[model samples]
Target: MKSIVILIFFLSSIIGLGQDYIFLESKNGFREIKLGTSVENYPEFNRKDNSNAELFKLSLNSKADYVYVGSNDDKIKTAKILFIYLTTNNNVISEIKVVTEKVLNVYAILNSAYGEPSSKHGDKWIWKTNNIECSIEGDQNTIPGYHIVYKDISNERIELKKMKLESTKKAQAEL
Candidate 1:
């Protein structure tokens, strides 16, 4: 009886460890796709029309720095992209935009894991544009979500809020 009870408890514990997030990656890094039921029908980048839309679907293990949206042209011109951070509901959230030529696809960089050393240690995500370089520390809040902080080369900081799953779903549906 004792062994049976212990085995049951262990099994229960393992089952309780349900997936909380999802990551979408393809060699280069993370991609910007939408998770959930609604957006799962669409392809990575539907070439039906002249749309440059791509969705970064999140599951129970998705994280990244940016979401790339490339063009279908050989040069990959006319790209529209954005940066994304994981949200509490396992969604990618960001406000950064990208407009480039010769675009192929976009990916995300798993900055750090929750409660990990990199997340708790020093700056997690760092970016530089033009002539500026910046670093951001992800130790400000204790929330279990992705926090996107943008720092220019000059050391200035910009904090982007968390991305929610419901909102992400809606956005993906529109796309």
Candidate 2:
């Protein structure tokens, strides 16, 4: 019984240590909060014209359940999304790039937030996209942007929805 208890404690500690939060900033005025250590360096994403983008801060929740990235710039004209997964050793196990040809913009007024639902309501998670927008060219056959949402542990999926700029504004206002 004592041996089993010790084993359980050891395993728990190992699991806990594997989770962490990291903040990344670029020279081009881009900032993001990310979970795990697999992050690109500042120079790779930063542009010479934007020096304010090189600073970022990240707050890690107790459970490491969510990470939020806030930026200092109000005028983000375009952004590409990437999902990264970290292994127990803090190495990036996988990375998937999301293409965005549409003119994407993140709303300066609202913040991006995500959280896990309380147990009383069962295991649920919510992610707020804030005032994100995309402007696709007329000739493009497919929707230009994607919605990435967390489904469960180790699972994230992207769902694409078609909409006009006017409708997108209305939908964001309703949210």
Candidate 3:
């Protein structure tokens, strides 16, 4: 009985990690949070109050905008998942990252929506296209959890974002 209790405590504290990447090719986004769309459209990204989640804060730098999904988001509905972080450029979402457990359900959901994964690399599964890339892999950077990253990788978009950043920096330097 004591051994069983210790095992339960150990299991409860560790987050499970499994899943192939989700979303269609060229998605450049996740759900309604599409890349190249105005960040103003999603008020959830504006709430920067996740400092209370001390464990989640440890792996991130200040540039990472930790998103707080709104009430309307009924979650993924089949897993212990959280839309933990995102980044925007030119006021548009460039990346979205999530952490999830019990992700077997997510694997099925994504398999149906996105078809076979492009490739599997050890514990990670990835789907890459000309426009975007999505992957689900083990990330022990902070807490024990699987990571899902959906990012825009269009070359034109990258160049445009770079130009904008440099232009803004140049403008700041003039000050």
Candidate 4:
């Protein structure tokens, strides 16, 4: 029993060390693209059709059609919204939201990387550190969701938008 516990602890620690590139942390950006990256770097693809300076989308060379980017920091710390969405201000990511069908895979990976979650509310699970707050929502019958929210946060407008989105979802669910 002690050996099994030790093994689990050892494996978990190894996974924890790689959190910098995990789904939540990478919400800042993906692959070569990262928060604070210059828009000019992606010269190969044109700016999305319905994008502006603050909130925009970028077409990437991947299975996903486009990645959403939102900046409340004057395009400084721009947040890249993939399966995990982020909001930023003054060039730092402040929050993240991830929704996907791969609940078990995501949960196992996050648990290994960040340890146990900090709280739980219904189908949602939350993990908070000094620097960030992350949450996962959904259940077996619905889509799985995840989020990484920053603390002493920045970008009120983005927060409002997030709230509106959640409200819409809740209203829909009720009906």
| lDDT to native, each model | 0.31, 0.27, 0.64, 0.46
Could you give me the TM-score of model 2 versus the true structure? 0.18
The digit string of per-residue lDDT tens for model 1 on 51-151 reads 42223333311433233344444121233323332221222222222222222221132223211112233534443332222233323344223333321
Clash-forming residue pairs, model 3:
none
Q: Cα deviation in Å at residue 108, candidate 3?
A: 2.6
Model 1: number of backbone collisions: 30
Error of 4 at 102 (Å): 2.7
User: Which residue pairs overlap in candidate 2's backbone?
Assistant: 27-46, 28-46, 28-47, 29-53, 33-69
Return the lDDT, model 3, position 19: 28
The candidate 3 region of ten consecutive residues with least summed lDDT is: 14-23
- How far residue 84's Cα lies from its native spot in candidate 2, in Å, is 15
Q: Sort by lDDT, best first: what order?
A: 3, 4, 1, 2
Write model 3 residue lDDT over 1-175, tens digit each, in one string: 9999999876654422112222354455777677767778876564455564553363632455547543434456556665456777877777777766645666656556666777888767777655777777764444455667787878667798999999999999999
- What are the per-residue Cα lDDT tens digits for candidate 4 across 82-105? 343434344343333333443356
Among all windows of ten consecutive residues in candidate 1, which has the lowest summed lDDT? Answer: 20-29
lDDT of 2 at 47: 19
TM-score of candidate 1 versus the correct structure, residues matched by position: 0.18
lDDT value, candidate 3, whole model: 0.64
Ranking by TM-score: 3, 4, 1, 2
Residue 84 in candidate 3, Cα distance off native in Å: 3.6
Better of 1 and 2 by TM-score: 1
